[model samples]
Target: MSFFYNYSANNQGLEIEGVQGQSVFSVAKGKVVYIGDTFKNYGKLIIIKHANNYLSMYGFNKNIFIKLNDQVSENQKISTIGCLDNNLSKLYFEIRFKGNPINLLKLFPNIKLKQH
Candidate 1:
């Protein structure tokens, strides 16, 4: 789904469905600022702060391999894909600038997003 997808709660990111346990990689090099499952709806989440006041979020992770404050490189395996209550596996990703959500497609025009 696109970042602007509307649901019960506003979707602030892009969602990519995949098989359970698929690898999830970081989009850029940054510090792992937050990593936890506290947000019930997000599952195990990881937020990275990058250069130029950008932040990337990776949600619905089954397992997170890195810890907070760790430096991560682009394409690094950070977590495994997680499933929803109905057993649908997906990765919820977002990129924010100055605390506002930005459309992933607008930023990465080369990405071919799947439409459901």
Candidate 2:
């Protein structure tokens, strides 16, 4: 790991560490906009566009169930947790309002996100 990566953790998005095979769900109702590993450190990523110009990103996914333009519901199963390394998986989740990353928990205060 580089020195920047170690220090940049604070600025990065939320990380939910877990093992493989854990289910990953859509945090909001939206249409699947993009899916792939374009973000190098994120492994497999999914970007969904929701109403009111909000976007939710579910990253580090191993198995994806939704495709481009697919209508997704809140809490719907979208994928399975993916490896962050050779032995562990994690979900790197975030929210964006008009393309600006925002504090996810501040917006979804009551969301009961699962942990591993």
Candidate 3:
């Protein structure tokens, strides 16, 4: 599964601020299986295979600093933030459990969003 953000005239991917030039750290210690441009729209992407048959996808990366089969530590920088073909600088992040997409926000209870 995938989550899509509305792209209006002003709503660019860069809306996800504080992530620009920020390290795309690994959520957990894992082994990198694929790194590089896997999707055209995503620009550069990286996939990590972790324990318990889990995998994470990070897309829209400006640069990929890791290689296939490379071991990555938890919170390690694997790639830099980038934009889609539409020039939206957003980081497409996803967590898959057995090839199923899960809401990443549910995993972190400490992160709270202010009410509008």
Candidate 4:
């Protein structure tokens, strides 16, 4: 039962800002599929493959706890928000089903997101 405040996302995923040192957790148990820091705009990025043909991406992370092909459990801490432009740290998260983007809230009904 995790929650986020003051966040926004478009059709692709949720954009959470001002979460500097907060811990980013794995939404569901899965195996690390990809981990890289080549996204010019997103900084370090991590991708995980879960059951039911689902995938989760965590972008712009400051630190990563697991490596590629590692197994992770639901709610496991994977990374922390990374510093962005102007020294502001934020997190970019996405959930996809069969390679198609899906609303995280709709995908995981228990996690709550409230914008202020």
Per-prediction TM-score: 0.84, 0.79, 0.71, 0.78
Q: Which candidate is the best by lDDT?
A: 1
Candidate with more favorable, higher lDDT: 2 or 4: 4
lDDT per residue for candidate 4 within 41-93, as digits (tens), equals 56899999999999998888988999999999999999888888779677878
Least lDDT summed over 10 consecutive residues: which range in candidate 3? 9-18
Model 1, stretches more than 4 Å misplaced?
1-11, 109-116
* Candidate 3 lDDT by residue in tens digits, 33-65: 877765665567688999998888877778788
**What number of backbone clashes does candidate 3 have, counting pairs of residues 3 or more apart or in separate chains?**
0
Q: Rank the candidates by TM-score, best first.
A: 1, 2, 4, 3
So what's the TM-score on candidate 2? 0.79
Residue 5 local lDDT, model 3: 40
lDDT, ranked from best to worst? 1, 4, 2, 3
Report the Cα lDDT for residue 83, model 4: 89
* Clash counts for the predictions, in order: 0, 0, 0, 0
Better model by TM-score: candidate 1 vs candidate 3? 1
Pick the TM-score winner: 1
User: What ranges in model 4 sit over 4 Å off?
Assistant: 1-11, 105-116
lDDT of 1 by residue, 1-116 (tens): 32323233455687777778999999999999999989887888999999999999988999889999999999999999988999888888888898888866666776665555
Clashes of 1: 0
Query: lDDT for every model?
Result: 0.83, 0.77, 0.68, 0.81
lDDT of 2 by residue, 1-116 (tens): 00111114333357776668789888889899999999887789999999999888877899899899999999999999887666766777777788877865666566555542
